[model samples]
Each structure stands twice: as structure tokens, then as C-alpha cells.
Target chain A: MIVIENVSLSHRDTPILRDIDLSLPRGGITALVGPNGAGKSSLFSLIARLQPLQKGRITVDDMPVDTTPSRTLAQRLAILRQDGAVANRLTVREIVGFGRFPHHRGRPAAEDLALVDAALSEFDLHSLADRFIDTLSGGQRQRAIVAMTFCQGTDYLLLDEPLNNLDMFHARQLMRCLRTIADERQRTAIIVLHDINQAASYADRIVALRDGRVIADGTPDDVLTEDHLESIFGYRMKVEHMNGKPFVLHHL
Target chain B: MPDRRMIVLAAIALIAVLLFLTVGLRGNVQFVLQLRALKLLALLQVAISIAVSTVLFQTVTANRILTPSIMGLDALYLFGQTALIFALGGFGYASLDAGTKFGAEVLLMIALAGALLWPLIRTRMDMNLMLLMGVTLGLLFRSLSQLLSRLLDPNAFAIVQTASFANFNMLRADLTILGTIITLAAVVVSWRARHVLDIVGLGREAAIGLGVSWIRTAAGLLLLVAILVAVSTALVGPVVFFGLLVAALAERVMRTQRHALLLPAAALIAIIILVGGQTLLQHGLGGASTLGVVIEFVGGLVFLALLFHESRK
Candidate 1:
């Protein structure tokens, strides 16, 4: 479980996130949906300790985010941001192997190597495993990075805008991968997503934010409505149901 | 393939060592050999120091184009010498023990490096901003050094000239020993932390997410860079772009991001450049110019080529 209490972040006198009180239970996918500048990334940054908290307490499971040693926090949680520039001249397999750093420090055991192999297969990257990251396409590189985060084997995973630059086919493939992993591995994942339909389809719960504040939070059926989304996004969108799931159509 | 490259580099470095030691010998065979050996040791130490320092600095900054010397370190070294000369005069400064002076310069460089670089790296500011600040500070230090140097007498000025420029002929045995010990220690630390450095090259966010304490690792590596740069500068006065030349060559030739291979490869390349270039300058050029001139010429060209290549990309 992750609990965020009285969290407020301000930069240069401009509040980025204000009084963001929320709790996320363990073992499910939570899609964080918000319009641009809605503090979605900021919230992920806070949870991952990428940015220091100014006014509040956050705890993952029982460990306080602020007080826990970085290694301890890393072993329990992993974060992949929107625009991460990887080291050049490294192959996909090598990059994924870095996720096991917290566990092995500098020396990798046999088990660590096995896990890296598993992550590569899990992401369907066997053919591209030996390819250099810089040589891979945007979608392929995204999958490799996601595979790295998953290889960390943390119970809690936070990904910010992981779908950026991906084509439709790759995006669907990635979302399906995340959904299956969260369910089968019994891991909790908080993903910041821009495509409402993707979130609506794969997210067990959807949390909506607008202007650094949470406007709505619940199951997709309860929160992803035309009225709620219009208020949150400052525009109207069509919400349709299919197979007991709500889908948002913002493009039309 | 990397192992093959390493072997080739090692062979080249060894051949250069042999040429440096025995290519030409005149009267007083023992004395000449001893002198050449001292110079060789000094060159090797400087090579190791600059190569390792530059590679590590690039890793932390995540910019292959930058070297530790860009952060006003060499300028500060020049400033230290000029300040000492101005306060104590030529004779007084020259009369001071060399060991004590070397110790003071190393300490001061470390202090200056920490003051100039720590906060920027710790706060994780824009790398371009950090680079700009470094360049500006370098200019300021150079200006200050020039101001003090102009006030000195001719004899003092000559002394400063010898210390200000890279001179392989002025190598000292005691200082070479000290530098060797310090450089060896840095090499060990870097080797031990090769895996950590690999992650560090991934940039700060990912490194932190991987649980490698980003701030601490960067700070430690920067400190190591300071030590390595200080030792090299103290031995061979500010070979400004040599680090860039060797580090770039190592990265280009090895084509590997792993520091364990990269560090040694860079070191070997540096040895080849310094010792081989020194041999050519002595034998081919007949000591018409210092090795520093040749290095600066070649290294400056490499730097420009790299800039051009990066721009095209």
C-alpha cells in the first residue's frame, strides 16, 4: 500500500501539487489520468522520490519514502520516467541487467542473470535482446526500458508517460503486457497515461487530476464519465461501455 | 573483439615504452637511462591520471565531450603558482621545497574543485549551465593569474613559465612516486566501482531509480577526478586537452560503455600518445618544440572534430 498525506509541492512560489492526499492499496493497476500540467508527472516524481516532498508524508507499504534508505526503497519500488536517456553503446540486454543493481550492487549472481533473461522474454524482446538501444526504434526502445523496470522485481512500479511516441499496435501491446504483469505477478503499478481509452481498458482503478488536485477517483465505470471528464479536462468527451468496461472517445 | 582491441592497445603501449627507454642512448649510459626512466615514469603517471580522470568525469556529467580540466582546475593551478610567486618573489618561491609546494597545490586544487563543482552537480542543475559556469570561472582564474604574473620580475616570470606549461623534461623522481601512488589508488577505486559507473552513465534519474545513490556516487567520482587532475597538473603543467584526446580515442576504439575496459583502454591510449609523442618530438623533431605543443595541436583538432560530428548528428 502507498499512502500520500497532505502532500504539497511548490516551485518558485508556484504550487505544482497541492494537498494531494491519497492512498493506493496493493496488487492492482492504477492509471493516473490528467490533462497537461495537471501534476500527474509531479505526483509520480514525488512517489518515486525524484523530487523531495515539501509538505507531507508518503509511505510505501510500511516504509516512509523520505526516511527509507535509497537502496531499500529501490528494492521495493521502481520508477521509469517519460524521457530517460540511456547510456550509449549498451545493448538492450545490458540495460535490462542494470535493473538488478540494487540487489547485487556490482556483482550479479546466477539468479540475477536468470531474472534478466526472464524479463527479456517477458517483454517479447528475445530477438532484439542483443541489439543496441540507440539502434532500436522508439517503440522497441520503450519496451526495453519497460523490461528493465520490470526486471527490478519490485512490488510497486511507477511509470510516467511510458506510452509516448509509440504507435497504436505497440501501445496496445505494451498496455496488455502491463495489465498481465500486474495481475499475474501480483504487483501494484501506477501509470500516468494520456490515452483515456487505454487507461479505461486496462486500469482496475482510474484517478483523475486537474490543476494539481484530484477531481475524481474510483473504478473506470464510476469516474470515467462524460460529465466528470468534461469537468476535469475542460472539454466534453464521449464515454461508451463495452463488455462491462467504460471507454472514453476524446478524438471525435 | 574488445579483448582483442585491449591486447593490441597494450602491445602498442609496450612498444612505445621500449622505444622511449632505448631508442637513443649517448655517453653516460647509466645516467641517461636513469633520467629517461624518471621521465618515462612521470609520463606514464600523467597518462594514467588524465585518462582515468577524463573518463570518469564524462560518465558523471554524461557528456563525452567534456573533461575535468574544463572546470577551471588547470586555471586554478596556474593561479596558485602565480600567487605564490607574487607573494614570495622568484627567489623565495623557488627556494621553497618542491614536495611541500606539490602538496599545497594538490590540496588547493581539490578545495577549488569542490567549491566550483560540488553544488552544481549535487543540485543536478542543467549541465549546460554547469559547463558555462566552469568556462566563466576558468576565464576569471586565468585573468587573475595573468594579473599576478605581469607584476613579477623576469627571473620570476621565467620560473612561472616553466611551471605554467607542460614540460616533460622537468620530471622529478620524488613527485613521480607520489603521483604513481595516488594514480594507482584512483585506478583501483575506479575499477572497483566500474559497475556503478556503468549505471551512472545511464543518467541521474535512472541511476537513482536503480538504487545506486546518485548524489553520493557522483560526488565521490568528482572528488576522485579532482585528485587525479591535481596529481597530473602538479607533475606535467596543465595538458589541457590531452585528457579529451585520450578519452575520446579510448571510447571510439573500444566501443564499450563498461568502465573496466574503458578505463584501461584510455590509459593505454594516453601512454601511447604521451610516450610515443615524446619520443617523436625528441628524435624526429629533435627537441625543437615541447611535447605540449604537439599534444595541444592534435588534441585541439580532435576536440573540434568531435564537436563537428556531434553537431551533424
Candidate 2:
């Protein structure tokens, strides 16, 4: 379980996240949905320790976020940001191998190599394993990054809008992959998703944020109500249920 | 599939050994050989220090076109020298021991680098801001040095001009020894931090995520860079773009990001460029011109090529 208490983040006097308190239980996919400037990325940044905690406490699986060593945090949780900028000219396999750095430092053993190969196969990146990351397409690069994060073998994976720049096919494919990982591997994933339907379809739970606060949080069936959507998005939207799953119709 | 790095390292070692041998073979002129050896040592020290420092700086900054010289260490050295001359006339400045001047210059350069880097290290300023501050400080120091130079007599001005050219022929033995020691120390420290440097090249956030103490690593690398720049600039004055040229070329040739490979590759390339260029100047050009001018010209071209290549890609 991930516990965030009174997490308020301000960057240079501008409040990015205001008193965001939430508890995410272990297992399954929890899709964080929000409009632009809803502090979704900021929250992820704080959770991942990409940004320091200013006025709050967070714990992952009973380990305190601030007090725990970074290596310990890295082993417990892995984060994939939206913009994955790599400075070096690294191959896909080598990048995935970097996930094992906290575990092995620089010297990689046989088990590390096996894990890297397993991650590459898990993401269907076996063929592109030897190729340079810079040469891969947007969707392929996204998958490679996801594979690298997964290779860390962390219990909780935080993906900040992993669907960005991905086509419809790749997007669905990635969601399916995440769903499988969560279900079979028992990894808890907190993914920030822009597409409402994608969230409604695959997410076990949806937490909506607006104006730096959580406006709604519940199972998809409960959170996808027209009234809740209207309050959270500040716009009227129709919600339809097909095969017991809610689908939001927001396009005018 | 050639191991160009190994070839280059071998070539540099060969040239350095030949130079060492040539100095030894001049049996009758012990004083000349000793002087020549000192100059060669100074050159080697400058080459290795600048090459290694620039490569590390580029890796941290994530830009191929920048060198530690861009952070105004050269200007600071000049300013320190000019300030000395201004305070205590030409004769007093010239009469001062070479070791004293070298020590003063290095101290000033390290202080300047610390001042310029402190804010960036303390806070989370963007790279552009840091670059801007460095360039601004360089400009300010250059203007101050120019002002002081203009105030001096023609004889004093002449002394300043000679001091600014980055020539190794006049290097003092004591200064060279001191520089050698300092450069080796910096290199040893940097060698220990090599693995962390690989993570640092991944940029700030990712490096932090990888359990790298970003601030400490950056500060340590910057200090190493400062020490190197100080030692090299004291030895060879300042060849601003030479480090950039060698580091960029090394990266292109090696096609790898590992610092273990990149650092040595850069150092070897730097030694080759300087030693080879000096040899060409000595033999082909008949020792008519300065090596700094030639290096700066080539380095400028390489910098432009890198920028254009990056943009096109």
C-alpha cells in the first residue's frame, strides 16, 4: 500500500499540489485521471522522489519515503516519467539493464542478465533489444522505457502518462500489458492516463484530480457517474455502461 | 571494426616516448634537455587535465560544444595576473618566482570557479542560467584584465602579452611539478567517481532516481573540473576550445557513453592533438607561429560541426 498524507507541494511559491491525502491499496491498476494543470505529474514527481517532499509524509509498503535510503526506495518503487530524455547513446538492452543498477551497481551477474532478457521479452522488445534507443519510434521507445522500469522488479510502478505519443493500437497494447503485469505478477501500478475511456476500460480504480486536489476517488463504476464527472471536469458528460463497465462520452 | 581508441592511445604514447627520448639523446646540453623535459611535462599535464576536465563537464552539461574554459577560468587567471601587475608594478610582478605566480593563478581560478558554481550547486537553477553566469563572469574578468593591461607601461604590457599566449617554452620547473601533482590528484579523485558519473550523464532527475547523490556528485565533479582547469590554464595559459574539440572527437570515434572509455579516450585524443599539432608546427611550419592559434581554429570548426550535426539530427 502507498500512503500519502497532507502532501502539499509548492514550486517557487506556486502551489502545484495542495493537501493531497490518499491511500492506494496494493495490487491492480489505479489510473490517476485529471485535466491539464491538475497536478497529476507533480504528485507523481513527489511520490517518485523526483521532487523533494516539502510539507508531507509518504510511505510505500510501510517504508517511510523521506527517511528510507534512495536505493531502498528504488527497489520498492520505480517511476517512468512522461519525457524520457536519455543523454547517452545506449542500446535498448543496455538501458533495460540499467534497471538493475540499484541491485548490482555496475557489475552485472548471470541473474541480472536473465532478468534483462526477461524484461525485453515481456515487452516484446526482443527483436529491438540490440538497436539504439534513439533509432526507435515513439511507441517502441515507450515500450522500451516501460520494459526498463519493469526490469527494476519493484512492487509498485508509477507511470506518468505512458500513453503519450502512442497510437491507438500501441496504447491499447500497452494497457493490456500493464493489466497482465498487475494481474499475474501482482505488481501495483499507478498510471496517469489522459484518455478517459482507457481509464474506464482497464483501471480497477480511478482517482480524479482538479485544482491540485482529489475531486473524486472510487471504483470505476462509482467514479464514472455523470454527476461526479461533471463536478470533476466542470463540464456535462454522459456516462454509459456496457457489459458492466462504464464508458464516458465527453466529446461534443 | 578497428579499435581506434587503442590505436590512438598507442600513438600518443609513442609520440610522448619519442619526445622523452629526444630530450634524453641531447647529451651535451644537460640544461637544455632539462628545460625541454620540463616544457614537455607541462604540455602533457595541460593536455591531460584539460581533456579530462572538458569531457566530464560536457557529460554533466549534456552539451558537446562546451568546455570548462567556457566557465571563465582563463579570464580569471588573466585577471589575477593583471591585478598583481596593477598592484605591484611590472618589475615586482616579473621578479616574483614562477612557482608563486602559478600558485596565485591556480588559487584565483579555483576561487572564481567556486563563486560561479556555488549558486548552481546550492539551488536548482537551469543549465542555461549557469552557462549564462559563467559567460558573464568571463566577460567581466576579461574586461577587468583589459582595463588593467591598458593602464600598464609598454614593458609591463609586453610581459602580460607573453604570459597570455599559453606557450610551454617558458614554464618553470617548480610550477610544472606543482601542476603535475595537482592534476594527478584530481584525476585520481575523478577515477573513483567514474561509475557515478555514468549515472550523472543521464540528467538530474534520472540520476537521483538511480540513487545518485546528485548535488554531491555534481559539486565534486565541478571541483575536479575547477582544479583541472586551474592547473592546465596555469601551465598553458588557456586554449579555450581545445578541450571541447578533443572530447567531442573522442565521443564520436568511440561511440560509447561509458566514462571509463570516454575519459581515457578524450585524454589520448587531447594528447594526440596537442603533441601532433606541436610537432607539425615545429617541423612543417618551421616553428613560425603559435600552436594555440591553430588549435583554436580547429576547435572552433569542430564546435560548429557538432552544433550543426545535432540540429540536423
Candidate 3:
């Protein structure tokens, strides 16, 4: 379980995240849904230790993020930021292979290679494994980066907007990939999502944030109601139930 | 086992060395060979130090276009030269022990480099800010040097001009021992951290995600790069574009950024360029100090081409 207590963050005198307290249990997908400037990415970055935590304490399975050795934390949790880039010419396989760096530390044994190969196939990246990341399409590159984060073989995956640049088909496929990891591998993934329907379909729990605070948190049916949607997104959307799932007609 | 590309680069580098040593065989074979050998050693030191430092720097900055020379380190060294000549009259300056002057100059460069670069690394300053700072600092140093040059009496000015000049063909061996020691140490440390350097090539957040103490690690590498640029620039004056040229060429030829391959490829490429260029200048071109100009020309072209290529992409 990941625990956050009274976390508040301000950037240049403007509050980015307010006094936030929450506990995320192990396993399944927990989706963070919010509008722009809602501090979703900021919260995600603090949890991943990408940014320094201000006025808060966060622990991942009883290990404090601030004090734990980077390698230790990396072994337990991996994060994929939205703005991932590769400056040099690197093949998708090579980039994914670096996911096992904590284990091999530059000397990759056969087991590490096997894990990398498994991750490639897991993400349906077998055909594009050897392709250069710069040459890949945006969706393909996104998948490749996701594959790398998954290959870290960690129990906790924190992804900030992993679905950006992905079309409908690829976005659904990527969410399904996350679902498989959560169900079969018994991993926990906290993903920042903008597509309400995608979060409703895949996430076991939905968290709604607005104005730098969590306003609603519960099962998809509980937090994604019409009124809740209006309060969160500043627009009323019809939430229709189809096949025991909430179909939010946000586009309509 | 060395990669095949590395093998080819090594072979070419070796051939360049042989040509440099044997091209103008004359006089007492022993004396002439010894003289060429010292020059060869000096050039090799400059080549290795500049190439390794530049590669490490570009990785930390997360760009192919920014070399350590971009940090105004070379300009700073030149300013130190002018400052030294200003304080001590030409005769006093030339009369001082070369070893002391070189030592003082290197120390001053490292001191300023620490001041300028350390905080930027610690705070994770934006790349654009760092670049702006570097350009602004470089301009200030260059202007200061020119101002000092203008203020000197005609005799002292002539002395400073001759003293501050970077002559590739006639390098003194006074500081060769110390420079070699520093360069070798930097290379070894750089090689030891080769794998970590690869991880750092992944941007800050990615590297931190992958278990690197991003700030401390990048800062350490930046210091190493500073020491390297200091040693080389102090020995041969500033060769701004040489490092950028070699590093970019190495990446293109090797086709990857894995430091295990990239570091050696860059050093080898630098050796080929410097030693080969020196050999050509002495034997083929009647020994002009135009090697520096030629490097600036080629390196500037490489820089522009890289920008164009990136923009097109």
C-alpha cells in the first residue's frame, strides 16, 4: 500500500496541490481523473519522487520515498511520465532493456534479457523491438515507453497520462495491457487519465480531483455520477448504464 | 570484446599516429623521433581529454550540440592568460616558471567552473537557462580579455599576444607530465562510470526512475568534465569546436549512445582528427597554425547541420 499524509505543494507562491491525504491499496488500477491545471501530474510526480515532496510524507509499502535508496525504490515502484524522450539513437529493445538496469547494473545476465523479451511481447512490441524510437509513430513510441516501465518488474506503476497521443484502438489496447498486469501479475497501477470512459471501463476505483483537492473517490459508479462529473469537469454529462458499466456520453 | 566499429576506429587512429610520427623522418633519428614523440604525446592528451569531456557533457546536458567548451571554460582560460600577463610585465610573465603558471591557470579555471556549473546542476536548472548563462558568461570573458589586451602597453601587448597564442606545432613539454596525469585519471573515472553515464543519458526523471541519484551523479560527471577541459585548454589554449566535432562524428559513425562504445569512439575520432591534421599541417601545408581555424570551420558546420537535422525531424 502507498500512503500519503497531509501533502501540500506550492510552486512560486501558487498552490499546486493542497493538503491531501489518501491511501492506495495494493493491486488493480486506480485512475486519477481531473481537468487541466488540476494538479494531477504534480501529485503523480511527488509520489514517483520525480519532484521533491513539500509539506507531506509518502510511503510505498512502509518505505519512505525521501530516504530510501533510489535503487531500492526503483525496484519496488516505476513511473512513466508523459514527456518521455530519447536524445540519442536507441532501439526500442535497448530502451526497454534499461528497465532491468537495477538488476543487472550494466552486465545483463540471460535472465534479464529474458525478462526484457517477455516485456516486449507482453506489450505487443515484438515487431517494433529493433526499430529506432525516433522513427516510430507517436503511438508506437508511447507503447515502447510503457513496455520499458513495465519491464522494470515492479509491483507499483505510476503512469502520468500514458494515453496521450494514442488513438482509440491503441489506447484501449494499452489499458487492457495494464489490466492484465494488475490481474495476473498482482501489480498496482495508478494512472492519470483524461478520458473518463477509459478510466470508468478499466479502473477499479476512480479518483476525481479539482482545484488541487480530491473531491470524490470511490468505485466508478460512485464517483463518476452526472452531478460529480459536473462538479469535476464544470460541465454536466449524461452517465448512461450499458451492460452493467457506466457509459459516460461526455462527447455528446 | 571490442565492437567492430570500435575496432575500425582504433585501426584508423593507430594509422594516424604512425603517420604523425614517421611522416618527416630526418636529422639524428633519435633526436628527431624524440621531439616528434613529445609533440605526439601532447596532441594525444588534448585529443582524449577534449573528446571524453565533450561526450560526458553532452550527455549531462541531454543534447548533442552542447559541449563543455560551450560553458565558456576556454574563454575563461584565455582571460586568465591575459590577466596573468597584465599583472606581471611581459618579461616577468615569461620569466616565471612555466609549471607554476600552468598550475595556477588550471586551478583558476576549475574554481570558476565549479562556481558556474555546480549550482545549475544541483537545482536542475532549465537547459535554456544554462545555455543563456553560458553564452552570456562567454561573451563577458571574451570582452574582458579584449579589454585587457587593449589596455596593455604596446610592448606588453605584443608579448601577451605571442604568449597567449595557441601554437599546435611548437607545444612545450613543461606541463606535459601533469596534464597527462590529470587526463589519464579523468579517462579512467569516465570509463568506470561508463554504464552510469548511459543511464544518465536518459533524461532526469527517467534516470531517477531507473534508480540513479540524478543530481549527485550528474554533478560528479560535470566536475570530471570541468577538470578535463581545464587540463586541455591550459595546455593547448581553447579548441572550442574540436570536442563537439569529435563527439557528433562518433555518434554518427557508431550509430548508438551506449557510452561503452561512444566514449572510445569519440576519443579515437579526436585522435584521428588532431594527429592527422597536425601531420598534414607540418609536412603537407608548410606548418601553419591554421589547424585551429580548420577545426572551428568543420565543427561549426557540424553544429549547424545538427540543428538543421533536428529541426527537420
TM-score of each: 0.95, 0.92, 0.95
Order the candidates by DockQ, highest first — what do you get? 1, 3, 2
lDDT of 1 by residue, A1-252 (tens): 999999999889999898999999998899999899999999999899887778999999979887788899999999999979997788899999999999998799999999999999987889998887888988889889988998999999999988887888878887887888788988999999998888889999999999899999999888999999999899998988899888788988
Residue-level lDDT of model 3, residues A110-197, one tens digit each, is 9999999998998788999878888888888888888889999999999999998888887888899899989998999999998899
- Predicted candidate 2 versus true structure: per-residue lDDT over A1-252, tens digit per residue: 999999998878888889999999889999999889999999998888777789989999888777778888888898888877876567788788878877877788999999999988887899998887888988888888778788888889999999887888878888998899899989899999988999999999999999899999989998999999888888999888898899899896
Note the DockQ of each predicted structure. 0.85, 0.62, 0.81
Model 3 residue pairs with clashes: none
CA shift of A135, model 3, Å: 1.2
TM-score of chain A of 2: 0.95
Please give me the DockQ of candidate 3 compared with the native complex: 0.81
Worst 10 residues of 2 chain B by lDDT: B17-26
Q: After best superposition, candidate 3 residue B179: deviation in angstroms?
A: 1.2
Q: lDDT by residue for model 1 over B1-313, one digit each (tens)? A: 8999999999999999999998888889999999999999998998888899999999999998888978888999998889888899888887888888888888888888788666766675665676677789889999998998888888888998888888877666888898889989988998899989999999989988998776678878988998999988987788756887888888877877889889999999899889988998899899988787877776567667866876798
Q: Second chain only: TM-score per model?
A: 0.90, 0.88, 0.89
The 10-residue segment with the lowest total lDDT in model 3 chain B? B162-171
